[model samples]
Target: MQRALLIAAVCVAAVALWLWGFGGAEHVTVWAAEGQRAAQNAMARGLRSLRAGDPGALTALLGLCFAYGVSHAAGPGHGKILIGGYGLAARVPLTRLCTLAVASSLAQAASAVALVYTGVLLLNWSRSYMQSLADSLMAPLSYGAIGLIGVWLVLRGLRKLAARNGDDGHGHDHNCNHAHGPTAQQAGAVRSLRDAFVLVGAVALRPCTGALFLLIITWRMGLAWQGIAGAVAMGLGTASVTLVVAAASVTLREGTLARIAAGPATTRALGLVEALAGATIAALALQLLLRAL
Candidate 1:
C-alpha cells in the first residue's frame, strides 16, 4: 500500500511539473526567452555591420545565429516536446531519431526563408502578413496535427494491450505454432516511419521567429545571402541541441524496456504508460489549440 501510494504521489508530481513548467505554452521559460533576446541583439548588431559594408561581420553574425539556434531550441517549444515525448514512448533508432531532429529543424529554417523570400519577391506580400500567417494559421494547424498524432498513439497502445489480453490463454504454444497477430515490436516499427513524418511536419510547419526576423532585416539591407547563411547555421545549432536530448530519451526508454519481463503485468504497465504519454501530449496540444482559436 505504501509503495502504491508513493508511486501515485510521484506520478501526480511529474504530471504537475510537466503541465505547469514543461508543457505550458504560457511558460516559455526565462532561459529560453533570454537566449532569444540575446540572439535578437546579435542579429541586430550583425545586420548593422553588414549594411555598413563590413564583410567581416558576416562570420560573427553566423556564429551568433548558431548560438541563437541552440538557445531557441532549448526553449519550451512543440518540436522539442514532441520529439522527446515520442522518444519516450516509441522505440525508434537513435540515428533515425536524430536524423528526424536535424531534418525538422532545418526544414523550419528553410520554411521561414522560403516563405519570406517568396512572399516579398514574387507575391508582393507584406512581412506583417507573413508573420500573421505563421502565428495565426500555421501554428494552430501544427498543434492540431500534434493532437491527432496523440490520438493515434493512444489507439495503437490500446490495440496492443487488447491483443496481449486476448492471447493470454494461448501463451504457451501459440507463439511456437499458431501464428498470432502483429507483435508489439513489429507494430511499433511499422508506424515508426509514419510517426517520424508526422513529427517532422509538426515541427517544420512552425517558423522560427529569429530566422524570420533576420531574413527580413537582411533582405531589406540587401544582404539576403548573409541571412540565409545565418539561418542555416542556426538550424544546425538547434539540431545539435535536439539530437542530444533525443539521444538521452532514446537511451533511457530503451534501457527501461530492456529490463521489463514478458509477463502480463509488465506488458500491461507498458501499455498504460504509452497511453498516458499520448494523453499528456494530446491534452497539452489541445490546450494550445483552444487558446489559438
Candidate 2:
C-alpha cells in the first residue's frame, strides 16, 4: 500500500541523516595534523578575545547555527534522518513530536558546548593525560550514543504499530507518547517560572556533532573556553529550525497522517524502513568499533 511505501522512504531518510550530519571522513578536508593545529590556534585566538565580552558568545551562536544548519542540509546521513523523521511526522501529530525533537536537539547541542568549555580546564589540569583520555573516549561515546538513538527510533516506531492489530497497509493512525512516571495532567500544567527553567534544563541533553566538533577544535587550539560559546551557538542553531517546525506542527491541520501512523499491519510494512536504518547504524558503529579496536 502507499502507506507501506512511505515507511521505506522514511527509513531511508533516517539513514541519510546520520551520513549527512556526522557520517564519514571523506567530507573532512583537513588532514589530522592540520586540523589539530587549526584547533589549537583557534582556541588560542578564542581565549585572547574572551575579554571582548559577549561578542565571542554571539559569534559562537552564529557559528553553531551555521554549522548545524549546513550539516543538517548537506550531510547525507543526517539529511536522511530528517527526511525520515519528517515522513513519520506526516503520520503523527507534529506538534507533540516536534517538542521531542526540540528537546533532543537542544540537549545534543548544549552537551557539545559544555564539553568544549570543559576542554580548557581538562587541558590545564592534566594536558597529555586529559588529551589521551578524551581521544580514547569521545569518538566511541559519540558513536555509541548516536547508534543508540537510531535503535530507539526503530523501537519506538515498532511499538506504535504493535499496540493495535487493526490498521495495516503500511501506516497507522495512532498518537504515541511514552513517558516515565506520571501523566501530564497529574503533574499539573501550571506555568511556574521554576518549572520552565527545569524544562529548559531537561531540554539540553541530546548529543550533537556541532558541539563535539567545536570541542575537538577548541581542545586542539588550547583555548577551551571557546567551546562553551560554540555549544550555546549550536543549541541556538538547531533550535532555529526545530522550533519553527514544532510551532508549525502545532498550528497545522491533523490529517490522514494520524490514521496510518500505527497498528500490526503497518508495523510489518514499516519493517524495511527500520531495517535500513538499523543496518546503516550498525555498519557505521561496527566500522568505528573496528577502527578503535
Candidate 3:
C-alpha cells in the first residue's frame, strides 16, 4: 500500500510539473496569451513580410526565433526541471545536482544548435523538397536521441539500485564518506577530463522538443535560415541561466554538512532518494521520447 501510494504521488507530481513547465507547448492559445505584446507585434510584422517574400522579414524572424529558442531552452528554470530528480537524492548534495543541471542545460543548447543547423543545411540542399525532408530528418533524430538517453537513464537507475543492495545497512557510512572537492591539480588530470566529457555527453543525450518545434515552424514559414538563427539564440539564452544555477548549487554542495550524516538509516534514506530520483528521470525521459515520436 505504501509503495502504491508513493508511485501515485510521483506520478501526480510529474504530471503537475510537466503541465506547469511545458503546457504551452501543447496549447497554442497559451503561448498567444502569454507572449509579450512587443514580441507578438514583432512576430506579426515579420510574418507579414515573410508571407510577402520579403527577404529582410525572413531574416529578422529567423534571428528572433533562434535567439529566443536557445535562450529559453537553456534557461536555469528549465535546468531545474531536467535535474530536479538529482537534486532530490539524499546522498547527493543539491549543489552537485545543480552542476548536473548546468551540464545538461549546456548539452541541450549545443544539441539544439546541431539540430537547427542540420535543418538549415537540409533545406538548402533539398531546395524544393525542403518540408518533407525536414520533418523526416528532424523527427527521427530527435525521438531517437530521447529513446537512447532514456535507456541510459534506466540503466543508471538499475546500477544505483544494485549498489544499494551491497550496503552494510548501518546507515550512512560516516567513516568512509568525505565530501571533498578535488584539488585544482587533480581536476586538470585526464580522469577529470573524461568525467567532464561524460557529464556533458550524458546531459545532452536527450533531445529537446523546443528546438524541433522551432525548426518546424521556421520551415513552414519559409524562413529556414532565420529558423536556425533563432534556435542558436534561444540555446545561448537558456544555457546562460542554467549554468549559473548549477554553479551556485555546486558551490553550496561543496560546503554542506548534511551530505556527511551517518548510520544505516541515513544510508537507506540516501539509497531511497537515489532510487526514486533515478526512476523518475528514466520514466520521464522515456515518456518524452514516446510522445515526440
Q: Which candidate is the best by TM-score?
A: 1
List, residue by residue over 1-293, the lDDT tens digit for candidate 2. 55554554455446436635675334532343354344445534554465356465546444534455434423222322332333332233444445555655565566555554565555453344434544466545544544554565466445544532333332634354543222223222343444234333433332454456556655665645555556656555555555554433322212222234443333444443444444555455555545644
In candidate 1, how many clashes are counted? 0
Clashes of each: 0, 37, 27
Which residue window of length 10 is worst by lDDT in model 1? 1-10
TM-score of each: 0.84, 0.46, 0.50
Where is model 2 poorest over a 10-residue stretch in terms of lDDT? 179-188
How does each model score on lDDT?
Answer: 0.77, 0.45, 0.49
Off by over 4 Å in 3: 1-67, 70-81, 86-123, 126-230, 240-260
Per-residue C-alpha lDDT of model 1 across residues 1-293, encoded as one tens digit per residue: 44543454455456447857685534556777898897888789878887787968888899899999988987767777677667666656778778888988999899899988998999998878988888899889988988887787787668768877787767376448654555446534634466667788888788887888888888988888989998999899899888876776665555555556545655665566677667767887888788877
> Which is the leading candidate under lDDT?
1
